[model samples]
Target chain A: MTRKILRNVGVPILSFVLLLLVWQWVVVGFHVASYIAPRPRQAFLAVTQNWSALWPLILGTIRETVYGFFVGAALGLGLGVIMAKVPVLQRIVYPVLVLSQAVPIIALAAPLVLILGFSVTPKVVIVAWIVFFPVTVNVLDGLTHVDKDLLNLARVYGASRWRTFIHIEIPATATPLFSGLKIGATYAVTGAIIGELAASDGASLALYQEHANANLNTAAVYGTTMVMTAIGITWFLLVVGVEVFATPWQRRTVARRWRRR
Target chain B: MTLLELRDVAKTFGDTIALSPTSLAIAEGSFVAIVGPSGCGKSTMFNVIAGLLTPDGGDVLVKGERVNGTTGHVGYMLQKDLLVPWRTVEDNITMAKRLTGRVSAADREEARAVARQYGLGDFLRHYPTALSGGMRQRVAFMRTLVTHQTLLLLDEPFGALDAQTRLEMQQWLLQVWRDTGRTVLFITHDVDESIFLSDRVIVMSPRPGRVVADFANPLPRPRTVDTLIEPAFIDLKTKVMRLLHREDA
Candidate 1:
């Protein structure tokens, strides 16, 4: 099992290096002008050289993303648990939650920016909007979709509702909750970027983005995008690592599912 | 003394009645097993007895007092070892005592002593996910024990185990039951299990269910799994099997 996990970690990293190697080759081979798409190495170099200069913008975006992620996740998970337990809440608010996720948050960005002004508020709101539905829906499904026999067993022990939540409901729903958090983390980065793009008139990166687009500083754009993707991937992998550590119960289930693949 | 009585207990899902006004009494200290073919009301009876559902017609009594919903006297274990994956075996067992009442240091020591006596002494700190299937079941059993409830309702507790594990568990359970001396009402479709464990076995008919047969196990006390091959065990098994075939007929 340790070998399997080590193999999984090593193989993916090597494969990613191979992929980038090919990417660098293809970009250089086709004489793809820097104006069109920057070389992978150049983009890396640009990001590295500008790393210190980029800190304030990166930190600013991370702050927006994190604030949004927490607010959204807490609300979503809380409402999800409520809806799962209470039919009236399910009837009233579930459809609204469904609708809330339907309208692409990208479509909502400009107006959100206008209303919330060119401030951190719009960005945080956008991130929260992006992170909410998946956490709520997945968690609610996990909490309510418990096995019938297990429910009966709890009842027989005369487990209090609170006790059942701690012992059965929450634990049973762990896989889905972890999945929700992982997905929420990925969207958090995008949500923050969207907030920046939409409300960037006075922001540090905003000024750079306006000038960069005209000069076709595509390397810079790709650098920002690559950095954001790295952040998102880091967030996702952190969640995945936590899931593996906390829910050893899922290791077998995940292995079995992976085996079928 | 009658500890629990079900009077006219009937549960229906839409037009289909699962339990039909079934009435039964469980005496204190009696280990009774309810047995029947699949789709019978054995599980329904256990649920009613456990107070998980509201019977359309009847009332459930715990210790001769009418109880409408889930109560504390009954400790239930099910087919699956529902130990929380994140909890240590000791944590799982200790959960039943957490919020109840203040205990002397001696009582906590006694709880640990009991767990150690039950073959789980070494595994207190280990998480449920670390244990094997059988060990997990033992932890589940120990958890039920921590509550110190008088009545135990086991719903096919060993049904999910392999046949070998299943037989071993039946014998192990007998020892535990004899040790604890809790009133046990176990539900299963396994005729042999019903015969092997209980002083009396109640057999029920299939859906739209009713108890069609009840047999008393005349086996000797301190029974071993080896006794299952004895003539008296064969005779008891034959009787339950006959009632089971009657359900098919």
Candidate 2:
């Protein structure tokens, strides 16, 4: 077991280290200027040197992203279930949602910041907006496209509408719902940063990036970008972890299906 | 007592008639099988009886109570096992009671006992995806039986199984039917299966389906695979085949 886990963990780490070494070698060997394309060592140095200043920015961005993720996820799941169960509501609301999706949430961020007074609310709301569509669409697809046989069984067995929704529809849609949540988690970070970019008084990663670029500290800008990527990847992994814990049955089901195939 | 009775049940979709007005009766504890070709409206009849769809004409009576355009009176197993993949065997088995808000400790205990009786005690916590096809059908059967409803409707329940598994399921179904004494209305296209498992076999005509013939299976009780070779079984098979062939011609 230990050896297997080592092989699983070791290969990715080794490959990543090799790529970084190659990147470092290429930058140093070619004498690339830092201002144009920051060297790997310089980017790493920028992060270390700016740690004290960047710490608060990272925390602020993370707070907004986390809040946005939960709010957006909750709204998405609730709306998805409602729209799936109530077709009349779906008919009234679906087209509007589709239209809203076409209008980029980033474009509305500045207006939202202006209206909401540049607080975390705009960022969180923007993040929620960004995430809400995919989550809702995935959930809708999963619920609507369920195995017809299962629905027939529910009908024949006297399952009430609510009962059917809880037992049949909800469980069936869980994997897809989690898939939406994972996508939403990654977008939450981007949404928060964009909102911060629109207007922010306090420290945020977006503010740092803007300041870094203004000072022509390209390495610092790269460092800020790296931090944001880290945050997004971390949040995504958290969502995946929760999904694994929540639906252990899905793994078993998939494995069983493969075995049969 | 007549557990279920259909009177002049006729259904149409748009301009296409699925079933012609027809009447049938099932006693309180007898096993009846319906045999027909593809598109003969055997499924339509089951849907009407199970209350998934209401017939355009006539009434569906369950225990003499007119139940039309409604569902959930009888236990129904579809052409496939239709077990919810996410739910455990025990949970699936107890779902009928759960849906009606009638599930209790006793009901759950009974479900467990029934699972054990059906040789699924070891798999009570296992999901449908983990079970073999035959095991999954057994789970479906336990689920249907646990409803404790006197009337059961099985729509080609073993039609998806291999020949060997299908034979075993037929024997298992017979034992279960005999033990429970529940009224069963089963649908199938297999003449041998219909004769082996049913007390009476009702054959329907094509398209705007109507009952062409109803034969009381003359095979003796406590039948087994050996019974398949019996002269009486062959004679009944020939008779049913002749009717089905005549309709095809």
Candidate 3:
């Protein structure tokens, strides 16, 4: 058990520390100005010293990300089910979904903020817009690709259409749904950050980063970025945790494969 | 009593004639096996009987009722266990019941009892991924049995197992068949298996499949590994093989 933990947790920490060391060495060895590039130690110091001021902005961005993620996930799942069930709708809306992704989120966010005014609504919309595409596409793929033999078995057993969808189709789609959610989780933070950068009268981590950049406080800028990165990682880990809980069979399958090898 | 009767059933997929006017009847509480070459419409016939495919002509009568393009008359099993990977062994076993309607406490009890009887009690809550191929097939069989259908159409249920596991599963299946006494229409390519497990062995002709020969096995009840070498079993197997070879010719 301890060995498993060491492999799981220790290895990533070790690699991350190595990266930090490399970053610090490059900053010091190059004799880079603090205004241009701060060392790892300076970035950490900046975050720790200014944590009191940065906390609310971090919380605000996190709130935006969380709210947007749930809204996007719900919408994506609903649309995906609708599209999967109705082939005509899928043919009509699928291309539109792809096009929505192709349009730059920055451009979309600016217009959204202008229209919605300076509130969390625009940020949530931006985040949802960014998060929905992966979720929808993955869900559609998952539903469409359910094993035909299982469907046949369901039919032979006289499963109603609703029963088949709930018992067979939904469970079959869980893995792919989680796949989209994980991808969306990583994008969610970026969406919130972009939304804040576009226009935020309220205090936000992105605004803090902009202020730090304008003052040439590169260490503070890096610190804000690190917090954003942390939030992104947290969101990703959260999705993974839920996936692990929801799909215990997947882990068993992987473990069985490992045992065979 | 006749449990299932297929009268001149035909299925054609565009230019390809999958099954050409096939007729057969299965008696209640009897085990029957159909042997045919690959692409000889064994699956099409099974699908037709299972109501997955509407026959181009004739009727499928289950217990004297025509059930065309309608399902739930028979429990069907395929070569692939097709157990839902996410569901537990007990869940997989009771899947047919769950799918058909609300599973009662008695239904769950029956599933538990069946699992325990079949030596899957300890793994009731275990997922299919954790089970072996043979075990998965057993779970699939249990799933079919719990559907409460008097007739079962098993399409090469043990075809994917290794030789040793296949033999074990055959014996296990025979025991289950004897215990349950459900009418079984088993499809396989193995002549020896057909003679061993079935009361009657059916041999189908090549593509656009039709039954060319149906032989009643004279082998006694409680057949075992020793039965494989018995004169009656060998004789029946040889006759089935010759008939199959003639079709190939």
Q: What ranges in model 3 sit over 4 Å off? A: A253-261
- Write model 3 residue lDDT over A1-261, tens digit each, in one string: 799889988999999899999998998899988888899888989999999999999999999999999999998999999999999999999999989989998989778977998899999998899888889999999999999999999998889999999899999999899999999999999999999999798688999999999998999999889999999998898899999877878766432323210
Give the Cα error of residue B227 in candidate 2, in Å.
0.9
Estimate, for each residue in B1-249, the C-alpha lDDT of model 3 and write its tens digit: 999999999999998898999889889999999998998888999999999999999999999999988998999999989998888787788887777787777888898999999998888777788889999999999989988799999999999999999999999999999999899999999888888899999888766678888898899989889999999988898898898898767
lDDT of 1 by residue, B1-249 (tens): 988888888888887778898788888889999898777877777777777777888898988888766656678888888777665666667655542434455555765787799787877666677787888888888878767888888888888888898888888888888888899999888888888889998988876888887777888888776788999999888888887897677
- Docking category of candidate 1: acceptable
Q: What's the true lDDT of residue A244 in model 2?
A: 74
Q: How accurate is candidate 2 locally (lDDT)?
A: 0.87
Question: In order, what fnat does every candidate score?
Answer: 0.34, 0.64, 0.75
Best by DockQ: 3
- Rank the models by TM-score, top first: 3, 2, 1
| Model 2, span B1-249: residue lDDT tens | 888899999999998788999899888999999998988989999999888898999999998899997887989997688777766777778888877786788888988899898788888777778889999899888889988889989989999999999999999999999999999999999988999998899999877778999999988999998999999999999999999999878
Ten-residue segment with the worst summed lDDT in candidate 3 chain B?
B205-214
All candidates' TM-scores?
Answer: 0.88, 0.94, 0.96
- Candidate number that wins on TM-score, 2 or 3: 3
The two-chain DockQ for each candidate, comma-separated, is 0.32, 0.52, 0.55
Better of 1 and 2 by TM-score: 2
- Candidate 1 pairs with clashing backbones: none
